[model samples]
Target: MENESVLIRYIKTKKGLLTVSGILATISTVVQFIPFYCIYKIIELLMLGNYSAEGLIHWSLVSMGSVLVGVVLLYASSMCSHVAAFDILYDIRMDLLQHLSKVSMGYFSQKSSGQLMKIIDQCVEKMESFIAHQIPDIVSALIFPLIYVGLMLMIDWRLGLVSLVPLFLAVAIYALLMGKTMKNNKVKQYHDALEAMNSNGVEYVRAMPAVKIFGLSVGNFKRFHQSIKDYRSLVMEWSNGFRSGYVLFTTLITSVVLFVMPFGAFLISQNPQDKTLSLTVMLFIILASGTTGPFMKLMYAASTFSNVNEGVKRVDEIFAEAPVKEQDNVTAFSGNRISFEEVSFSYIPGSPVLKKVSFELKPNTMNALVGPSGGGKSTIAQLLLRFYEPTEGTIKIGATDIRETTIDTLMQNVSFVFQDVTLFNDSIEENIRMGNRIASIEDIRRVAKMARCDEFIQELPNGYQTKIGEQGVFLSKGEAQRVSIARALLKNSPILVLDEATAYADAENEVYIQQAIGELVKGKTVLIIAHRLWTIQHVDQILVCDKGEIQATGTHEELLAGNPLYQKLWAINEETKEWEVK
Candidate 1:
């Protein structure tokens, strides 16, 4: 089966350990048959009217010893599997995380965090369970039957062949049933349903604030409710479909004596002289019937193979994505000027978001991009960050094409502070230190002061060490933005990109944020995207963009005097500022 192949390939790294486990499991399973053989011998002695207490006690001790040895071997086998399984899990998770770090940010836009979490957490755990527990079960399951059937045939070939007939029939029926289920693609459907539910559940929880504020009902949370309903329906359908086949399989496999007893009795009827031998063979057949229980357990464990295979395939899909290529011979840049030369890009093919956008920022100069909401201003910033490669043209930092250098090299020279500032649930000092890992206490404090965050940070109970969550303290948007600004200032990169950095600042914090920006951008090649027209009025240059094209590019006074679009925007900005509350 495809599932079997997936598991085999995945465990190739741990094949040595798994092989040892398998060998041990097979030995344990073979040892288990010793008690059955001892019982048969004792029964034979009784039938022959040679009852001896010492003989009985000896055989009983032998049987108990075999059982004890088998238990030890089985425990050793499980121990090996457990060690290998945990090691393999660690390797798998580490490899996945490393690959994700190298993958382009564009990959994240198409995949949800919930979906990735399910794959990384749940799917990997499934693989671990399969490797640790199910693998030993499968090994014993497979070897037990062969050894058991061989012993039966060695005793009496007729009853052995008869006993195997029901097993073969049960297997055929099982195959047919599984074939139908596979054809229905139930496994894939189940995986999809679970992923959807995970995604929707995460989304619903994240939207709880809005839900409560609007008094949203279950109907309002349609996507989450629908996913739950759909998952329930699929589970019910799968269980209902398997119900009949499962009953039939269990009955046929477990009832081996039903076939063997009849054939066995018929054989004994023909030979009265060898009555003791015939009766002993029948007892052996009855004892061997116990194997069906282990077989059923094996089948139950094996059924999960499909889910494991599906999980492996999903994990492999993530690993298969091409990472951002780094040039082997590339070196760092020496200048600070940034330029976009006729660059074009599209999130989706055929429909361009940035149409041959061209721009330049001189070193140590302020440049502003003024545009409508969807006018590609953010796309330009994203491209500069190399989150996604441009479909056409080139972007250069200083004299080097950005694609020619490694992402690490490019990122080391530039810093960005966007509108949506995300602060981790950690201490204030730690969050600021993320900008520059090697920054000392004094260095962090210097930037914090520059960003106007030191005053507020000092006011908190733990000062710089205060955690940023419900347990410690919470920050307003403006305060959070200042912290982010502190981070950017600490990095002290030559090139700076500010995407609506002051958008969330209150009127009071705006003055401090402006002063922070003044300190941060003093000697950097700055490219700022702003909606507040008044803020950029004194900038060195402003580019007015509309419909993914630059309509005009000049100083603010030049634009207001000659560009009609700019004039109208400026007028509206002025009007909004002067409007009084009723």
Candidate 2:
């Protein structure tokens, strides 16, 4: 019953095709039993001494033809199921991708790539076996039993009852194994172990370089090693626990002949009449024993229902996440000024990252936000991008509230160059084109020159067409920073946010990047979040932030003379610059 719910939930969209497949398979199963009936009739005729050579030959041909047709129908049924399964997989993947695209970036931060990949790839793939093969097997297993029982009863009621004894035992054993106390908990534990192992494995692989540098062995990687051990232990425990029940179930289902033969012989001994009828009944029982084979196959297929259930649950959980809301009627802003009015936010309740933060940046001016690492500088920038909404207060662009505008409109008017740069596996030109998809090759080249990306990009084998991989055509951190700057330059938005944009650049790259940033921020309302005090020494205004609050608002010299925290931070930066190897 639980397995039925899982199938129904996922197969909702593909129900029509699955229904057709089930119907065809059921028909095929019924046809498959035709030969068994034919054989029984041939034996009965021979026992009655009414069979001729031609009659025997005709019955043999009929049995052979039934088997052949049954095979063709089974093949056709499988083809339909495969088509439906693959189509369902495609739809599932597409739906997941679309949902993820709309979800908050915080979702990605909370989930590892490995975990998401396992759900999207492995979990979805696991459903293929259930949909393509198991569905048909289940249908045939269910329908075959009813037809088999009826045929057996027609021969002899005593033999029919004997045939069902093993089936009843198998069912009882299966029920005990799948009862609430064991099956649900054990299956849940197994899936949890698998997910943990997948996530830990990905984390370990990603940290391999650091591990090697630190002379770390697999045993030293505590979390990854522990996850692997836990998974192995859980699998072994489940196997050991379920082994006896599984063996008993298999033995009982297949040993139907054992009970049938003994009982048939007992009946014959008691009656001592109609010897031919007795022999025919025993022969029919032998042929009917094969019915348990389909039931055994059904049981094996049913075992995977737990995995399918887990996968569907995970997929549904992803779908349930709320995306950033956008107003249907979007308002247009007339200017580039930005403002935050009493804005506050927290990734978790009772742990505010930004507390009642309020600030405003005038149009076509440079402003800087200087603060410590956890002083909410990055959070402020992300809020403007609508990566998350303020739990309280309002953020606005020009004269209109940001919430009043569509996300697409908000993105179009703002550009960001953060410390972390992510470039796709595509060509350099293609990566730059992401900023403005319709930008021409000439526009791309111009921005590349302006952002100083052309300097190293031109040196590559294919220049702008060069492909990138994790290890392929490696770019220095500074060069990658310049490419990101080129993307921002091509975007040419009215508002620009630079969060440690030049953090990775060396002295030479820093000079080039600053020059490029100068061109990109021209006549734009810009907010710069920097740790290095020297970089923003000449900005139009500086807001000193500490503990999620603005401590002071002044120029570099003003802050140095006015705010002790700012003065101390500046002093530390100055001291670091003068220090050298002794």
lDDT score of residue 542 within candidate 1: 96
What clash count goes with each model? 0, 0
What residue pairs are clashing in model 2? Answer: none
Question: What TM-score, to 2 decimals, does candidate 2 have?
Answer: 0.90
Error of 1 at 133 (Å): 2.2
lDDT agreement with native, every candidate: 0.88, 0.85
The ten-residue window of minimal lDDT in model 1 covers 1-10
Q: Residue 3: error of model 2 in Å?
A: 17
lDDT of 1 by residue, 1-582 (tens): 334443465588899999999999989988988888788778877888888999988899999999999999999999999988998888889888999988888899888888899999999999999999889999898888877778778867777787888888887888887788789998889989999889888999989999999999666889989999999999999999999988999899888878877776777778867966576555757565786877886776767787787888898888788999889876788699888899999899988998988888888899999977899989889889988899999999888999998888888898999899999999999999989999999999999999999999999999999999868899999999999999999999999999999898889999989999999999899999999999998989999988888889999989989999899889889999988889
Error of 2 at 35 (Å): 3.6
Q: Provide the TM-score for each candidate, comma-separated.
A: 0.90, 0.90
Prediction 2 global C-alpha lDDT: 0.85
What stretches of model 1 exceed 4 Å from their correct place? 1-10, 41-57, 261-275, 278-282, 425-427, 455-474, 508-512, 578-582
